[model samples]
Target: MLIVGLTGGIGTGKSTVSKVLRDAGFPVVDADVVAREVVEPGTHTLEKIKLTFGPDIIKNGALDRHKLGDIVFSNNTELARLNAIMQPVINSAMVDKIAFWRAQKVPVLIIDVPLLFERGYENNDYIDKVVVVTTSPQVQLERVKARDNLDETKAQNRINSQMPLADKIARADYLLDNNGDISFLEEQIKNLMTELKGIAPKYGTK
Candidate 1:
């Protein structure tokens, strides 16, 4: 199967594109969803996290993501520490999902990872293509602020926490501009799907 890594900075419409791909019948393994799964109430990963960051970050029986986000997003050291604990598990889960899809004989499989480059998934030999979704910095800031209900500085901080969009675009095999409305974005995705289908066969036999 042609394994595609789909990524974008926070509030860059990566989820929207993933949804479109899902609607069009492609299998998409979302890293955020897998991240949550790996840290569920009784998991070893959650125990390690609690040990590392303390138990206050857990609410009821689950990891309080917002609480953890508040802690890590402001502190690079803390964020790196968290990534150190989580990335290996997440990567393993993603690889398992890709193998599952390949065994099912799918032509293309999309791995929706927000930190694809940050976590080094781009360098993986199995990843056939990397698609980065982008938007103007102003639009990105506004969307992040509105979606997460944060002030300008906090939203900007969240945006700054990731690798820069310009750097991601420079490394992209494909780019999806999300500056316009959903229809515009969908049209681009339609064209992208055509190209992906054409390329998938070349890698599917691997």
Candidate 2:
């Protein structure tokens, strides 16, 4: 399996691009999905979180994502603490899924990870390339604020919490511009997937 790692800062339309790839019939392992999975109601990961961060972050026996986000979004230290707790469990689950697919003889796979660069997936043999979706800082700020129903300050804090978009772009094997309209993004994705098909013909069939 040829694993293509996808990442982008908050509000950069990485999820949308991931959908396009899946729509094109490629297998995609979404890290965000596994992050939620690892911390579900009865999991040891969630138990650890409750023990470490206190029980308040849980509501109705489930992780209160919003409550936790409110706690960590503004404080870099708290965010790091949360990442340290969650990342390993999430990565382990993701690795298992990738292994399952590879054993099934999947021709290529897409691993959508928002923190691909930060967590150092660059060193992973499975990831053949890294794609970063990006747009202007102002646009990102506005989009994040609108999408998350956050004020400018809170939204900016969330954006600042991630590795900078510029740094991600610099490290990218493929950089995509999400600074334009959806049609433009769709066109760009189509062209990019066409190129990908050439590189990995077995999985590129659409």
Clashing pairs in 2: none
Candidate 2: where is the Cα deviation over 4 Å? 201-206
lDDT of 2 by residue, 1-206 (tens): 56789999999999999999999998999999999899888999999899988989899999998889988998888888898899888878988999888777767688999889888887877788888999999999999999999999999988988899999999988888999999999998898787777787655332
Clashes per prediction? Answer: 0, 0
Best by TM-score: 1
Clashing pairs in 1: none
Error of 2 at 148 (Å): 0.7
Q: lDDT of all the models against the reference? A: 0.93, 0.88
What C-alpha root-mean-square deviation, in Å, does candidate 2 show against the real structure? Answer: 2.5
Error of model 1, residue 143, in angstroms: 0.6
lDDT, candidate 1, 1-206, per-residue tens: 88899999899999999999999999999999999899999999999999999989889989998889888999999999998999899989988888888899999999999999988888899888999999999999999999999999989989999999999999999999999999999999999999999988888578
